[model samples]
Target: MGSNVDNALFFLVSTLFKLAIWVLILRVALQLVRADFFNPVSQLVWRLTQPVVGPLSGIVPRYRQWDLAGVLVLYVLAVLYIYAVFAILDYRVGLLPALWLGLLSLITMTLMLLTFSIFVQAILSWLGPGVNNRAGSVLWSLNEPLLSRIRRIVPMVSGIDLSPLVAILLLQVFYYLVPLHPVLR
Candidate 1:
């Protein structure tokens, strides 16, 4: 009975820790993508995230209306939290390896989200102009820089946009080819 109780407690703690890290990651990603920060939902996310991000803001500088400092804070917290969890489980691993994995996972997930956003926008555009969809706007904003670069390299063929295709392919490469870390391999 005592062993079962201990196991339950450990599970609860680990689950909570993971939940916190996921929330932090989502907050950072939303900020990076410049979601509607003024809305009530965003305000709630910010309030929940500020506990971790506020302190790190001092060390990392903000960039171009984006809260990069907050994102860095989320990354650091995720690495530390994973390390702690591994330690609790008595797993032997180096911190750097875990950090790299965490960061890569974060990046891969971010790119996937961005790619999905672009695809969604492309579909909406097909429906008609002035869709006034918030998600479409967010996708357009996030993808504009990448699409612009691709445009410079590859001129639009027959007035068809190819940037989204290129972006999706690049994201796929990162998702599949990149090792989480050299040492982890």
Candidate 2:
């Protein structure tokens, strides 16, 4: 009975920690896209996450309007959360394994976000120019820099947008081929 209670508490805390990390990521992504940070949704996320990020921001400082400190703090939180969850579940995670898994999760999240943006862009284009979809706008804001660079390099083949395909392929390579820290292997 006590064990069950302990497990329940562990699960609850782990889930909340994970949710907090995701909320922080969403806040950063919103900032990246120039979303109204003061909107109810954004403000709620900021409020939930700032308690953790606020102090870290002071330590690392901001650069070029980019929140490298926030990203680093999120990464550290993710690693610590993973470690705690494993410890609570009685699983051993060596340093290398933890680092590799954390990196893998980060890469996966980034690729998923990129793929989602590409899918949104494709759908918006199909819906034609007049439809003003906010999702499309957000996707464009997130993806435009990467896609623009690709466009300059790749050019449009037969008037098709190959940038998305290229981006997906690159993401796939990172997902599968990259050798993680040796300790993980």
Candidate 3:
């Protein structure tokens, strides 16, 4: 009974922390992609993250399109989340190891976000065809830069834009190419 209760508690804590870490990551990525602030999804993400990020903004400067403060806060939160999970699980890891794992988690989360954004954007494109509604706009904001770069390089095949395909493919390749062993060791 005690072991079961402990396991349940571990799961609850870990899930909550993981969700928080994901939101923080989204806060950073949306800024990195320059997602439209007025979009409902963008506004929701900002509202969720603003409290944590607002306090750190003065300390960490923004670089061009990227919000450096948000990124830093995400990193701090990721590391803390990992540490908390380890503690809750009653598993011990050295400080350096925990930090490295946290970094690996961050990278994985970023790639996941990119892949998800691209996939959703692709679906939205297909569903609405030529519509430029707020949902489409939000998706475009998240996907446009990377897709535009891919479009430039890949070219349209017979006037059918294949940039989304290429972008998703490239993101998948990067996701699989990310090394996890280094962080684990």
- Candidate 1 vs candidate 3, lDDT winner: 3
**Candidate 2 structure quality by residue, lDDT tens digits, 111-144:** 6557666776877877786576555565676677
Q: After superposing candidate 2, which stretches have Cα over 4 Å from the reference?
A: 1-22, 29-48, 55-59, 95-97, 128-130, 179-185
At residue 129, give the lDDT of candidate 1. Answer: 71
> What tens digits encode model 3's per-residue C-alpha lDDT throughout 100-151?
8789878877777778878888888788889888867877877787888887
lDDT of 1 by residue, 1-185 (tens): 13876567667765675567656655766676677777555567689989778887888888876677777776776576557655666676686778776777566556656667678777887887767766566557557777888878877889887887887887778766766543222
Q: How accurate is candidate 1 locally (lDDT)?
A: 0.68
Pairs of colliding residues, candidate 1:
none
lDDT of predicted model 2: 0.70
Ordered by TM-score, highest first, the candidates read: 3, 2, 1
Against the reference, the lDDT scores of all candidates come to 0.68, 0.70, 0.78
- Report the C-alpha displacement of residue 45, candidate 3, in angstroms: 1.1
Q: Looking at model 3, how many pairs of residues clash?
A: 0
Model 1: ten consecutive residues of lowest lDDT: 176-185
Clash count per candidate: 0, 0, 0
